[model samples]
Target: MPQIMQMGEHAVIGLDGLEALLAGLKRRDYRLIGPTLRDQAIVYDDIGGTADLPQGFGDEQDGGRYRLVRRGDARLFGYAVGPQSWKHYLHPPMLSLWRAERHGQSFDIIESEEILPRFAFLGVRACELNAIALQDRVFLGDEYVDLHYRRRRDGAFIVAVNCSHAGGTCFCVSMKTGPKVAAGFDLALTEVLVGDAHSFVVEIGSAEGAELLAELPARKASAEDLAAAAAIVAGTAANMGRDMETEGLQDLLARNLDHKLWDDVAQRCLTCANCTMVCPTCFCTSVEDASDLAAETAERKRRWDSCFTMDFSHLPGGSVRNSAKSRYRQWMTHKLSTWFDQFGTSGCVGCGRCITWCPVGIDITEEVRAIRDDAPK
Candidate 1:
């Protein structure tokens, strides 16, 4: 049964109620995954029970970000989304696609599809929901469907969160993906522990989600609870501190290809590629082949590779983007500007993972602002 219950007149879900829902799904052969404190940070992992979840936890972050110590108040799922996203599951860093085996003149081509694990992502944030949708448009759209990506994404259950706290670098409001989630989640949860009754305002977006909400220990919500939940969303949206102007900005950057901004940023940019690695939307990859000296058998492995790498854009003679400055321009332009042309959407969701993870604290928004504020020629 679904954990969604009534808070008098409005729907509500308590922590215990949510655990019950996860447990219910697990019993139905679903592999449950949720956030837990690990590696000194909150990371997504398989969940055994509610005990595995980071309850009453929140994090503070800054540029070249560091997570704040756990909060004084214990509110499980209080924190904003962390650097790790659902991308790891859908677009893994490395994967083996096929192995060519041969004996004498006879050979076999063995290709295997990644058997997707049935799991419930317990606390996907609003912005992450947008990120996931963006990837779907890229990987599952009309042109080409990534078989592995489709299999993993098609059936996975989503239990999304309405972020209670905004990270210092977060610009979801500017990106127009968050503060309040509107669509694309199976089950949306807004933590409404405004008083003694710690619970979530639950809304069902799919029948599967509605059915899950029915199994929990819950009561019908009152109008007051609904009002409180709305207030919470309102308050969170108002609190978003970072904003960006994406209107016509893509063409602005593309037109200004030779703009001095690229040279200035290249000075600080290490071409380390941490931004691409951490970015939830960047999906470039490279393949490697392993074989025996006799060429009897071999395997092909696909690994996440970056354009920042000197070899990524290589041709017969040399790499097209042979310089760090040119590579940086390519990455930023593709990400911020031309991505619309290639994907029909912006590649960045403004999660700020790139800003936070870059070793030298190079902020993309800062660069955009410098470009925007530069004198018009």
Candidate 2:
């Protein structure tokens, strides 16, 4: 179901094309969800039409954070990424697996069933793509695939974006995952505002993308178009503030487990679980069992859990990490240091969601820098 278009180099599509693309997905019964300015933040929600998108909306971010603001123009999709990543839909924070009902002699297990709606997520950021990949490694490729997650991810489609602007807390360039769109996306778009043409230079990354491209009216690209996109990304890369040297970090944290730097961070951290809640890679969860008044019927639900919780590491002997310092160390070490040994990849995508959403403004980048810089001394 694909049609190929030979793009010379300057192939660009107008804003109308974006609408057409959404309509096409709707025809195919794909639920198109995208970003909308809500609660002083950009949150993804059901988009019945283009107007639902955050038009002329942007965000101001800081050490731990985001606040939405009006933009210069009313470009619906003009905004950059948001703290609410695609994981909210793909890997739901809380979900019900099944329910059990007691009968005269036996009990019935009612499994939760969702038709696995087809989705087309627009405006996905590069770091978000990495986050999805990391989640895939856990839910799909782990010892057990989360049936709910697999259902949502397998049938969903992606439309990634190259960031034209970076927020205050953004460090994707430092993480080497952004400023430009890369792999793991069906289609990538670079919004170009050149001379008088304000359009997007789109690149098809999959067979499905080719089919979508055929439906849109686009012209051949010129060298100038490519150059403009490169310039945008290059400029963005240079503007990034935070720098994280993750080289040999996994080994360093694993070796130096008793470092005193963690205590400093612990004193500042409240263990309020904000970091894990916003983090896309933190997948640890716990389950709850609820019973009706008669206690004959019960419903079980799984919810996101945090290692910062007092009982997160509770064992038969005792709590492995009793002190806040030990809990903080366990979290940071797992995030930047020991995750490699467990998951074979960096547990962080550097989306800065953790930093921006933290109520106390505890910066993960600064913490890592302090530990990394002092490790040598």
Candidate 3:
């Protein structure tokens, strides 16, 4: 028998009750998006119920390598993040800004009629929540907010998951972002499995979450359940496979503008821009205008861009960061140092997507360590 102990707003639900939660969200007109196995990797996609989740599967991730493996149990969220981040849904790779049709003597502008969809993101990791918060500062905090991003973000519901396992490339412990969720979620869940029983300890973070929990088959969580959840998160934190020393990291990069370490990494870097694509906080984009052959119709589009591209630095004189060394340095410095000046926080969330997805296994933490080690003593 499960003991019902009321401690604040925490509750426990059987693993089977997860379907009820999903159903409630869908009934409320939310497009549920969660992790699913696709192309041999766990990627986010539309999920209708527990069947759509990556059951009995986990992921093994290291620098430049990611593979899915069987965990022998039906653990819905037993893996780490893959190449796709929530940014793909919120800030799409491509968007049509506007279109225009030629008139007799002028062109009439046609306004974009795109409607942002309401999404409920499930199985979001703690570090990913911080990444979303950081992106909120970028797209919603500026003087002129991104209308599209704001619309989508405003109606989105976040269901965060406290990590029970850490990837080999994960370094959220050093970034002070994860292993446990502190905030920025509607409902947070910690998967608990012992012996042959499986359940989840759910914590309500908002009124909407409380209402949703009421609709699910959950009971008040006991003290033992809460303690078990804490221990699981603690174990994950202690076993982080990577670490990043952030002491004076901002100044360290700023002073090493001419560091030779940049050249060393550039030789191995393919300038593929995979890091930026997989990064949850990278917000660079480029705009293009396309016209029909008859020049009667034209449309303006914006697509995700990266600083690693030579064309990204094209100016009146020429490309400023022409060499790969300069381009890599610019990207790293801006991500670690200049981002603080611009956003008041580190652009990176220590999710390690950049390291895992990079074709050359270029680790950001390793680069930072190399720079710090080679600095003038």
Candidate 4:
């Protein structure tokens, strides 16, 4: 057995070593989840090995647009954030809360017996890491705790990947969240491709991460390797595809509740909830209870719901946010402005998934700028 690694250790590993790392995680009984080619796009799914990674594939992302493009070099993690995030694994879209069965006017309640999965998240980006941390605040907070989220989160291992290239819609630099991973990962990897040599500079963050690294055939990272990795991250930061002026953004949105720009955006908004669906931190959900035709079995289930839906804000009389303008306002303002007051952090991570996945190409940063520009002086 390989010795467990300690914190603050740096090492270098080749492509073959990465495969060994995967096999090692499997041996520890972790279900591997990472990005792979699916339906012409890179999506997070079950992986057998590193071969399942989307190698030599980059992505093009802009407002309401996403496409996969082939890269000249065979870099395993050469793309930016895709449509699907690690949230799909952590916070499932649909979940069963509980179930009950009836017998002659008597009811027997049964808790959900859903088996939890221990996930080893591979290829997590910096912005995505921040998003995960934000959700942790929501689910694993001091006052109230989500046992389901806590159990799954506590058991998962993280493998964060530093961005080598910026996406067309990325603004993680302006958000101060990406290009270079800060923390919250078991192991962080920076892919280095120089001349004919290709390897990963690994930074061990936790004891488990260190133990996993010890399983691989890794060498101590040289000064040149560290410099190369830093250069790649710096280059990505310098070439960010988008920018958001976050200074006083919370107050800005608070003052512009009735901004005309909201009305303008509503014209193009579909209220399809794609932004909320793709957003890694949008945690809104609705619950329902239903019984079988024979009224013998009943279940309580929870499904993801967005504020944009007409029924989401329905009251005793009618829907409070009846207009598209109000729904868009609620989402954008809550995400960029009021979320700080509620969560002690900004809701948006600047991943640009909400922008790329929005059918009408509604850019959150652009809307913020417009609101600020049009605000009373």
Please give, for residues 228-312, the per-residue lDDT of candidate 2 as tens digits. 8788778877776466777777887876777888778778888899888878778888999999999799998988889999888
RMSD of each: 2.5, 2.3, 2.1, 1.3
Residue pairs with clashing backbones, model 2: 9-221, 10-221, 10-222, 11-221, 64-355, 64-356, 65-356
| Candidate 3, pairs of clashing residues | none
Q: Considering lDDT, which of the candidate structures 2 and 4 is the better prediction for this target?
A: 4
For each candidate, give its TM-score against the true structure: 0.94, 0.94, 0.97, 0.98
Give the clash count for each candidate.
Answer: 24, 7, 0, 1
Q: Taking the tens digit of each residue's C-alpha lDDT, what string does model 4 give over 1-377? A: 24665687789999998999899989989999999999999999999998999999999999999999999998999999998888887888988989999989899999987687689999999999999999999998878898767778987999999999999899998888997888999999999987668899999988889988988898888898899999999999998888999998888888888789988999999999999999999999999999999999999998899999999999999999999999999999898889999988789898999999998899988898888887997
Evaluate model 2: give its TM-score. 0.94
TM-score: the better of candidates 2 and 3: 3
lDDT (Cα atoms) of all candidates against the true structure: 0.80, 0.79, 0.90, 0.91
Positional deviation of residue 165's Cα in model 4 after best superposition, in angstroms: 1.3
Highest TM-score, which number? 4
- Superposed by TM-score, candidate 2 places the C-alpha of residue 127 at a distance from the truth, in angstroms, of 0.5
Instruction: Output the worst ten-in-a-row residue range by lDDT, candidate 1.
Output: 1-10
Q: Could you give candidate 3's per-residue lDDT for residues 300-359 as a string of tens digits?
A: 999999999999999999999898899888888998999999999999889999999999
- Point to the candidate with the largest lDDT: 4
Question: What lDDT does candidate 3 reach at residue 134?
Answer: 93
